[model samples]
Target: MDLKTASSLHRLRLVSAPEAVSFLLLLVCSVLKRTTEFNAVPVMGAIHGVLFVVYVLFWLDAWNRTRWSIGTAALYFLLSVLPLGGFYAERKLKAEAENAVIASRARAESAVKA
Candidate 1:
């Protein structure tokens, strides 16, 4: 992919895992607050909220730069809400980046030959 697309995806990938983790942590904190003497929901909630927003922003940038189909965009959005989905998205993005690199190389080689 082009540098802008790659950078956007990379930022999204970076935020996604943390956002997922924070979401899980927030769940745990909620349970703790409800069932025990411990309460961390406020702090965890804020962290998760920021990360989630960052994920959305980066996701939008990636979508715009990559020009993904509606289905693809929806899939990414779905992944954001699932706790384990970010990891899968990261793997898929890596593959996409590799494909883009290969395609770029092929184009460069063709241009040289022509």
Candidate 2:
């Protein structure tokens, strides 16, 4: 694949877990703030907000560079909102990267043979 696609995919993979963790932490903080004296929601909210924005920008870049179908792009976009979605997206991206690597290697082997 093109370098832009690879770069965007790599970035998306990197941010996925961090964003998910931040989301879960923010959720926990929200609950705690409501149920008890604990109140870390503001801090967690800011962290999650930044991560979410980064995730969205990476997602858009990947979509544009990778030329994903609308449906595929929507799925990735939807996954960002769901609490556990980042993990899933990360897994999918990793698998795609692996497959891309394998394909590239196979192409290289064939070129060498030729």
Candidate 3:
């Protein structure tokens, strides 16, 4: 992948897990609000909301840069909604970025030899 695409993917990957965590925390806080006096729903909700927006923006950028197919884009979008799915998305994105780096290096090495 090109540098822009790689960077976008990196950004998305970086946000994915944290976004997932925030979502989980928000859910927990919602439960706590109902069951106990400990209420952090507003705070957690805002945090998760910001992260979700950031994730979506980054996702869009990565999708645009990489020219992913409809299925691939849909999969990523779906992952954002499902609980704990961000972790899986992060893992997948990391692997993809690593593979891109490896391929980029191989191409560079071959060009140097030529």
Q: Please give the distance, in angstroms, between residue 65's alpha carbon in candidate 3 and its true position after superposition.
A: 0.5
Q: RMSD in angstroms, all models?
A: 1.0, 1.0, 1.1
Instruction: Please report how far candidate 2 places residue 44 from its true position, in Å.
Output: 0.5
lDDT of each: 0.89, 0.94, 0.95
lDDT of 2 by residue, 1-114 (tens): 766788899999999999999999999999999999999999999999999999999999999998899999999999899999999999999999889888888998999999
Decreasing lDDT order of the candidates = 3, 2, 1
Q: What TM-score do all the candidates reach, one by one? A: 0.94, 0.94, 0.94
Instruction: Please tell me which predicted candidate would have the highest lDDT against the true structure.
Output: 3
CA deviation > 4 Å runs, candidate 3:
none
lDDT at 97, model 1: 82
Please report the candidate that would top TM-score against the real structure: 2
Residue 103, candidate 1: C-alpha displacement in angstroms: 1.2
Q: What overall lDDT, based on C-alpha atoms, would model 1 receive against the true structure? A: 0.89
